[model samples]
Structure formats: structure tokens, C-alpha cells
Target: MAKEIVCRDAGYDCDFMIRSENEEELIEVVQQHAQETHDTEMSQEDIRGAWKTV
Candidate 1:
């Protein structure tokens, strides 16, 4: 099963899907989520850190 991570943006839960076995892919998914869904700008470093636990 794919691992899922929820992030809060604008006081809403932004659900992001992260497939296991790849950290980079998860990071990219999170970046897109933050930009398209959350409308919050995140730095590359922040994105990397977010996916660290997922």
C-alpha cells in the first residue's frame, strides 16, 4: 500500500500520497500538493524535510 501523509495548509488537511521505496518521488508529490492544493509556497529544503517522515 502507498504511504499517505497529511499536511495542513490554510487550515485544511492536504492529503498527499507517497508510494513506498522512493523518497524523492514523495518529495515531489508533496511539493505539488503544497503548490496546487494549499497555495502555500515551500522551499526545496522544507519539502525534503516534510517527506522525511513519510
Candidate 2:
């Protein structure tokens, strides 16, 4: 099954959400979103730490 994460649930104010076949892909999408939309940089560990599975 695919996994998902909600940005708000992870403490971000934005409503960014993503789904992927695996954790790595999810993290990649989240990282890209953060960079493009939020002007933020997150490491793999940081993203994983903040993620809330949905």
C-alpha cells in the first residue's frame, strides 16, 4: 500500500500533502515541496522526524 504525510500534521502551516509507494519517495517529494514552496531545506532525518503518516 502507498503511504502519505500531511504537512499540517507535521507542524507546518501549509496544507502540503504527499503520497508515495515508499518512505524514501515520500520524503523526496516533501523535501522538494519544502524547498520550492517554503524556501526551506530539510535533511532526510529532519523530514522523517517531522512526518506524520496519513
Candidate 3:
């Protein structure tokens, strides 16, 4: 089953939700979204730390 993480759940005001086949993929997409939308630089550890498996 696919997993998901919501930006709000990560303490962000955005309602962005990333769903993927695995946590790695989900983190990748989230990282890209963070950079493109939020203009924030997040490391793998930051993404993983904020991730809420759903």
C-alpha cells in the first residue's frame, strides 16, 4: 500500500499532501515541493523527521 505525509502534520500551514509507493519516494516529492513551493532547503533527515506515516 502507498504511504502519505501531509505538510500540515509537519507543522506547516500548507495543505500539501504527498502520496507514494514508499517513504523514500514520498520524501523525494516532499523535498521537491518544499524547495519549489516553500523555497526551503531541507535535508533528508529533516524530511524524515517531519514525516508522518499515513
The lDDT for every candidate, in the order shown, is 0.60, 0.79, 0.79
lDDT of 2: 0.79
lDDT tens digits by residue: candidate 3, 13-40: 9989877777778778888999998899
**TM-score: model 2 vs. ground truth:** 0.71
State how far residue 7 of model 2 sits from its true place (Å). 1.6
Query: What TM value does model 3 have?
Result: 0.72
The TM-score obtained by model 1 is 0.55
Top candidate by TM-score: 3
Q: How many pairs of residues collide in each model?
A: 0, 0, 0
In candidate 2, position 35 carries an lDDT of 92
The C-alpha RMSD in Å for every predicted model, in order, reads 3.8, 2.0, 1.8
Off by more than 4 A, model 3: 1-3
Instruction: Name the weakest run of 10 consecutive residues (lDDT summed) in model 2.
Output: 45-54
Task: Sort every candidate by TM-score, greatest first.
Answer: 3, 2, 1
